[model samples]
Target: MYKAKIFVNYKPSVLDPKATVIQQTLTRLGQTNVDSVMVGKYFELVLQGNEAAVNEQVAKLCSEMLANVNMETYRYTLEEVEA
Candidate 1:
């Protein structure tokens, strides 16, 4: 078995309105030390396959479904796991 930890986030050049709002809210709540806030998605998938196959599937899913290639970026880590 393989475990995939995927992370998806907006590109730096893309403006994240939600993150901006959270940052503003934090400032209002006196969390002045927070310079910025970024919103992202994390997914943990347990897949049954060899490392090479799992890696290819993970990359395809990230690009085709989990993230928008034009605006978001994605990365993942894979590890062997006991079923």
Candidate 2:
């Protein structure tokens, strides 16, 4: 088995309105130390496949469907796991 930890985030060039709102809210609540906030997606996936195969498939999915190449960037860490 394989375990995949994936993170999807908006490109730096893309404006994150949700994160901007969160940052503003935090500032209003007196958490002024926070410089900024960016929202993203996180996922833990368990797959029944070899490391090489799982890695390839995960990369394919990330580029093809999991993230928007133009505006979002995605990265994943794959590791062996017990079945």
Clashing pairs in 1: none
Candidate number achieving the greatest TM-score relative to the actual structure:
1
- Whole-model alpha-carbon lDDT for candidate 2: 0.93
Consecutive 10-residue window with the lowest summed lDDT within model 2: 43-52
Q: For all the candidates, what are their Cα RMSDs to the real structure? A: 0.6, 0.8
Give residue 77's error in model 1 in angstroms: 0.6
State in Å the error of residue 78, model 2. 0.9
Would you estimate the TM-scores of all the predictions?
0.96, 0.95
Candidate 2 off by > 4 Å: none
**lDDT tens per residue, model 1, 4-73:** 9999999999999999999999999999999889999999999998899999999999999999999999
Q: Local distance difference test, per candidate?
A: 0.96, 0.93
TM-score of 1: 0.96
- Candidate 1 lDDT score at position 10: 96
